[model samples]
Target chain A: MLFSLDPRISRLELPESAPAPPDKAALDQFPTYEVFHQRKENTAYVYVGPVHAPEADVAFLFGKEQFSRRFPCTGMWVVPTEAIRVTEYGDDQQSVYDRLPLLPADVLAATDAAVTEAYDIFHLKKRGKAHTHVGQVQATSPEAALQAAKAAFGDQRPVVNVWVIRSTDLLRSDEADRDMWTTTPDKKYREAIAYKVQDRIDRFKQEG
Target chain B: MYGSASTHDIPTQATTGLENEDPILLAEFEARIARGEKIEPTDWMPQLYRKQLTRMIEQHAHSEIIGSLPEGTWITRAPGFRRKMAQMAKVQDEVGHAQLLYSAAETLGKTREQMLSDLINGKSKYSNVFNYPTPTWADSNVISWLIDAGAIVNQMANAKGSYGPYCRALDRICAEEAFHLKYGHDAVVHMATGTPIQRKMMQEALNRWWPAIMTFFGPSDKMSTHTEILMRWKVKMATNDACRQQFLDMYVPKILEIGLTLPDANLRKNEDGVWEFSEPDWEDFKRVINGDGPCNAERIAVRRAAEENGAWVRRAMQQPKAQYVRPLA
Candidate 1:
C-alpha cells in the first residue's frame, strides 16, 4: 500500500452511527449552468465555473455570490451546461481542425440553408490558462447566441467582450496542409529564443 | 496554499530503483526540469515521479478540504456582518482550493472519488494542524494568520515545482490566500490591540496554537530521510526544517510585535541564524496523527457526515450511462 496505517489503533471508525439513506425524491440537485463574466465594456467574457440553478436568472444570482462577491465584475451570464458544445484536444488524435478541410462555398451554402439556426463555438486555447475558449451556446438567432454567450462565459475571470458567431461560420484547414499552421521559423520574434536587447546594449556601452 | 507537511511516519528513500530506468529518457526529463520546463499531463514521466506527485498533491487537496472545517464553523458566529462575509468567503476559497487540487491530482490518474474516500476512511492524512480544534473565534483568527502564513511558505516554494497543473493551481490559490492572510491579520490585530477581553482571547488562542504551528512543517528534516530525490525532481520544494525556519523568521517578529505571546518561552533565533526552540512533542504529534487528538474524531465525523449527506447530490448529478473522462487541464 502507498499509504501508511497505524498498527497501534487497529481500526479507526466514524463515531456516530450512519444516518438513514436519503430518498431519491428528496434529492433536489439543480441543473448545472456555466457562468461567464465581463469585467468591463471592452474586455472579453470568461468562463468562471458552473452553478446549479433551475433557471438562468437564478444561476446569475448564484454566480454573483459565488464568484463576483468580493471581486470586481461588471456583468454576468448563465446558460445551461448541456447547451455548450466542447471540443477537447487530445495528444493521440490530430486536432479536428488540423484534419478537416474548409467546406466548399456550395456545400457551405447548402448546409447553411438547411440549418437557419447558428450556434456559438468556444475553444480553449491552452492548458493551465483561462480565456482561450470561453465556450459557445446554441441558439436560433445571432441575438440569442450573443445573449447566451454572455451568461455562459462571463464572470469567472476578467472578460471585457465576448465573441458571437454562427457555428457554420467556422472554417478549417486541410490535413495535408497542416505544416502551414504548424511551422514557425521566426525564432527572433519569440521572446524565448530572442537574444536579450539589454545585454547587447550593455556590451556596446562596455566596448565604448 | 495547502501543502503542509504530514506528521505521519516518514517513508524511507523511496526513489531507489530509478537508477534502472532508461537513462536517456531520465536525462531528457531532468534536462527539461533543469531548463525550468513544466511537465504537462501527457508528457512522459517516471512512474515514481507520478506516484510521488500524486500522493503529495492528493494530500494537499485533502488538507484544503479538511482545513476548511476548523474555520468554517465560525461563519455563522462571526461577530458582525463584515466578519461574517469575510469568513464565509475565506472558507469558500479553501474549498475551492480543494476542488482545484483534486482536479490537478486527477491529472496524475487518481480519481477525486478515490482521494475523498481515502480521506474519510483514514487511509490518507491531511496537514496535522487541522486535527486540532478551533474552540473560539480567536483560534480561527490564529489559523487564518499563522497557519496560512506557514502554508504560504510551503506553497510559494512548491508553486515553482515542475508539474504544470499543480503549479498553475497554486498560483491562483496563493493569490486568494494572500487576501485570506490579510483578512486574518486584520482580525488578529483587532483582537490583540483591542480591549482586555479581546487581547486575552487572542493571547490564549496564540498560546494554544503556537505548538501546532511549530510542528506544521512536520518533524525535523535531520531526523528523516530528507526526501533528497523529491528535491531533485522539484516535487518537494524545501525541507521541513527549512520551511519551519523560514516561517519562524518571517512570522515570529510579527507575532511578538502584535503583543501576543507564543507558548514557547525559549523560541528565538541564535547567532548562527538558526531558529532555536523547544521541540514540539513528536510523540503527541504521532498520537494525534494516529487518531487520538482532541478534534480528530469530530473532524472526521463531520467530514464523513458531509460525505454521507452529499451522496444524494452526487448520485443525482451522475448521468446513467455516461462514461468517465479525464478532465483536460
Candidate 2:
C-alpha cells in the first residue's frame, strides 16, 4: 500500500503500483487566450501572458486570477489566441510597419464597410518585451486594421512586433468595478515586507 | 518555488549533433544569442535547443505542481488562523505558478496535455528533493524557508535566460517567491525562538532536510560539449555547483543566526570562500530519484489519482469542436 505521513493521503489507500493511464487527448486543457492588463488608470494595457479556457467569460476570470491576484491591476483584457493577427517580428532598432506589404487603394476600398469595425493594436517596443496597447483603428477586416495601424502609429520606431485583435473579441474588465483590486489590509502577511525576522533573530542572539 | 538548477534529462556526452544543422542558420542563431536577443517561439532554432528547453521548462512546471502537495497538506493543521491563511495562499501561489509555467512550456510546441500525461506516467522528473516527505510542521517550515530560498537562487539566474516565454514566466514567479521566502523565514524564526519544545522540533527538521538540500542542485556537472552549447545558447544559465554555493553563501548565516545547527559537522567556509561539507550520498540520491525513495510511490500514486479523478470534469468542460493552439507569449 502507498503510505504517507499526511493522514489525508493515507486515507486514500492508493495501490502501490497502477498501470499508467491512457494519454490525454488533444485540447484537454482547452484553447489558449492571450491576456493583457492595465496597471493603472490611463495606462496602456500590456500583455501579461496567456490562459487556457473554454470560452471568453472563463478566460476573463482565469486571466484576472492569474495576472491580477498578486499584482495591482486597474483593468484587464482577454482575447482568443486565434483572433489576434501577428506580424513578422522586426529587429530591435526597426519598426515592423516598414515591412508591411502595401495594399493598393482600390483593394482597400473594395473591402471597406459603411460602419467601420474597431480593432485594438498592440506593439512590442523591443525584442523580448511584452506588447502594449498603441491605439485603436477602424477597419473592415484584420488586414485593413494592419494598414490603418501603420497610418496611426507607424512613426513610432523600434516596434519589434505587433498584435491586432477586433475590439469586439476582447472581454475586458468593467471600469465600474474598481473596488475588486483593493486587497484587504489583513492580507499584508502575503507580502515579503510583512515579516520582521531580523528582530527576533537579534533577540535570540542576545539571549545566547 | 521549487525549481532546481539541474535538469535530469540533459545529455552528458560531447556529441550534440551540431554538424547536422545548416551552417548558415546555426551561425545566425548563435550570433543572436551572443547579442543578447531573446528567442521567441516562432524563431528558427536548433532541435537540441528546443528539446532541452522543453524538458527543462516542463520539469520545472511539474515541480511546482507536485511541490504543493506536501505544503498543501499543512493548510488544515497550521498553528493558527493567520498561519493557516498564509499557508493556503502560498500553496495557491505554487499551483498558479504551475499554470503559468505549463503555458510557457506550451509556447515551445509541446501541448500541456502531453506534458501532464508524461508527468503522471513518471516519464518526466521534477526536483528530486520533493520525493521525500514533510513529516512535521517544522519539516514543512524547512521547505518554505530553505527550499524556496534555494529555488530563488536557481530561478534568478534563469530569469535572464534566452527564451522569451520562459524568462517572462520566471519574472513573475520570482516576484511571488520573495513573499514565500520571507513568510517561511518568519515561520522558522518564530518556532526557533519559541519554547524549548518548539526549538527542538525546528532543529530536528533542519537535520532531516539538510542532506536533501545539499543534493538540491544535483551532482557536480561534468563539462561536455552539450553543456557548453546549452550555456552559450543561454539554456543552462549556471552550473549546478555555482547555484548550490550561492545558496549556501546566502542562507547558511541566516540559519546560524537563528541559533539552529545544520546537520553536517564539516559544513564550513574554506580559505577560498567555498563551502565544504560531507558529500551527499550520490547512491541514495540516484536511488530516490529513480523511484525507490521513501515516498516516491506515494507521490506518484497521489498524482495519478488526481488525474484519474479529474478526467470527467475536464471532459465535461471541454468545448465541442475546440481546436488546440499553442499559447502565444
Computed on C-alphas against the true complex, the DockQ of each candidate is 0.05, 0.82
Off by over 4 Å in 1: A1-40, A44-70, A73-208, B6-10, B222-226
Say which candidate scores most in TM-score: 2
User: lDDT by residue for model 1 over A83-200, one digit each (tens)?
Assistant: 5444323222123234223445565445435545656645433333343345557565554554445456543333322335455443222345434322224322211122223343
For residue B74, give model 1's deviation from the true position in Å: 2.1
Specify the highest-lDDT model's number: 2
The sequence of per-residue lDDT tens digits that candidate 2 reaches over residues B1-329 is 98866898688864787889999999998888899889989888999999999999999999999999889889999999989989998999999999999998999899999999999999999999999888899999999999999999999999999999999899999999999999999999999999999999999999999999999998998888888889999999999999999999999998988889888989999999999999999999999999988877887889899988888988889899888877888
Candidate 2 error regions (>4 Å): A111-115, A184-186
User: Which docking class does model 1 fall in?
Assistant: incorrect
Taking chain B only, the TM-score of every model is 0.96, 0.98
The Cα error of candidate 1 at residue B206, in Å, is 1.1
Q: What is the interface RMSD of each candidate, in Å?
A: 14.2, 1.0
Q: After superposition, how far is residue A23 of candidate 1 from its true place, in Å?
A: 20
lDDT of 2 at B269: 99
Per-chain TM-score of chain B, candidate 1?
A: 0.96
